[model samples]
Target: MSQDTQPAYRRILLKLSGEALLGEHHYGVDPAVLSQVAEEVCELSRRGVEVGIVIGGGNIFRGAGLAEGGVDRVTGDHMGMLATVINALALQDAIERAGRFCRVMSAIRINQVCEDYIRRRAVRHLEKGRVVVFAAGTGNPFFTTDSAASLRAIEINADLMIKATKVDGVYDADPFTQTDARRFDRLTYDDALERRLGVMDTTALVMCRDNELPIRVMNMFAKGDLQRLVMGESVGTLVEGSRQ
Candidate 1:
């Protein structure tokens, strides 16, 4: 597909924060939000883009917070991983309910439920135009869904990684707190690092830069923002440069 004739990305990795599934609530998965997401994703698939998704488990579990209260780190991480599975299941169901085919693959062994994360199987699923949802945070402790998103993006050879976020783009400071922060339409990895931006973790950014994958950070909750961003419109901050 040519840029002038088709969708901007042939394949894409979508990183959805668990908080995004909350709709108006600050926590937990909301059915309505999940349905809306399904609608959006179905629309994207109909337009001929291969979509692979990675959803965070923050709403159901946040390991870092659990560890602060004296819970065993590994236990907390496992809980976090399970939380991601729950979200993945919800997303899978929602997507299917929207009448699109999809597969839920888990990094951890949960064969009775979702397919174990196998790189080739995942690629095959996407190639068939089925949305693939990756869950369980790389089946390891101390890694984040951000890192998992990057890993999947590379493994599947996605054209871009889309971070669906609360904000439209990367700002110099917290937009909710800093009135003076400037919103960027585009940026380089070095510039983001020098400014201490929190668009993604250092590891995720470095991996993307190293792989030379273009990343777009956008407020997906906004109406049609995902479509706009995926179509290569200026809907968010496009992080440019080689992978670090």
Candidate 2:
């Protein structure tokens, strides 16, 4: 589609996992993956689709993983939140280098580094066509970044939440373990919940369901997947309140 063409959705909340930033590595940010992601985001932004990203921290630290190692849950979660900030900063830098103005807003106060998150301010940034990166995961210890994404998407009144995953779409069973696992092109929120599809955390999925928000689960590294989605092409599984 041309840059002047209207995108299928006016605005979107892009949820990225910290693991995705690792690319081929086992830990930390990979420069190549970061560049590719930045380019994809820049393309979408330049084409007039407002973008807000909520990224996870598993690549650096995961509270749940730390807790299993006997670390204090709250302390580990705080560390995880900080890891997310690190990622958000890196992403903001990449976005700027990609030629789009970007803002990093944290749910927790880190006045020295990033702006404190304000819903109105975020909305205004999107209105001005600036990409917004939300960090720190809802400022709560227990909640995952997925919850933050859902909450922010609803607050921003986004057309949909795009969850960039390693898998192409939601499967009826675990794709890695089940050779016969079936992928759904679309499904209702209730069905996803009843079948225990681990597309998103329970809290996040429930929040989206209650608000009637739709979610698209797509492979982040898939070539042109984001563009196809913005252009209304079938790229991944669509989960909504009903089969729309």
Candidate 3:
């Protein structure tokens, strides 16, 4: 596709796992991986696809993991949120270095470093062709970043939500362990929920369903996966509400 071509989804919310930034490392962000991700986003922006990104904190920290280690759940979650901010900053820097403008907006106030997320401001950024990165996971302790991605996508009027992960798509069982695992190319929101498929958290899935927002879960490590998805090529598991 031409770099000037219009994307299938005019605007999209990208959900990235913090662990994906780790690459082959045991933990934390890997510079090579982060740079590639930034390059992908930059390429999409160059193609006129308005993109908003939300990244998780699993690489640096996990609130649930800390809670299991005897830390306070709320405190652990707060730390996790801060971890996301760090990743957001790194990504913002990478995008900017790639000659694209990017804004880091945090749910929690970090005024000196980035702007506080305001719905109007974020929409305006997209209108002006600036990539917006959302951090801090809803600014609430209990919620996951997946829910934050859904909430922000709806607020920004995104055409679709994309969950970028290590796996290519959602399957009936864990593909790594289950040799016969079946991957679904398409699924009704209700069926995904009824089957207890972990496409995303139940809350995030419900939010998308209620809003009628479609989601594509695809593997980020796969070459050209994001580009293909934006160009309307089928490369991931699609989830949406069933129409009457």
Q: CA RMSD for every model?
A: 2.5, 1.0, 1.0
Instruction: Show the lowest summed lDDT stretch of 10 residues, model 1.
Output: 1-10
What is the C-alpha lDDT profile of model 3 across 126-160, one tens digit per residue? 98999999999999998999999999999999999
lDDT of 2 by residue, 51-120 (tens): 9999999999999999999999999999999999999999999999999999999999999999999999
Candidate 3 least-lDDT 10 residues: 1-10
Worst 10 residues of 2 by lDDT: 1-10
Residue 8's lDDT in candidate 2:
95
For model 3 the local lDDT of residue 120 reads 99
* Local lDDT at 80 for model 3: 99
Q: Number of clashes in every candidate structure?
A: 5, 0, 0
Q: TM-score of each candidate? A: 0.95, 0.97, 0.97
Over 34-55, each residue of candidate 1 has an lDDT whose tens digit, in order, gives 9989999998898889999999
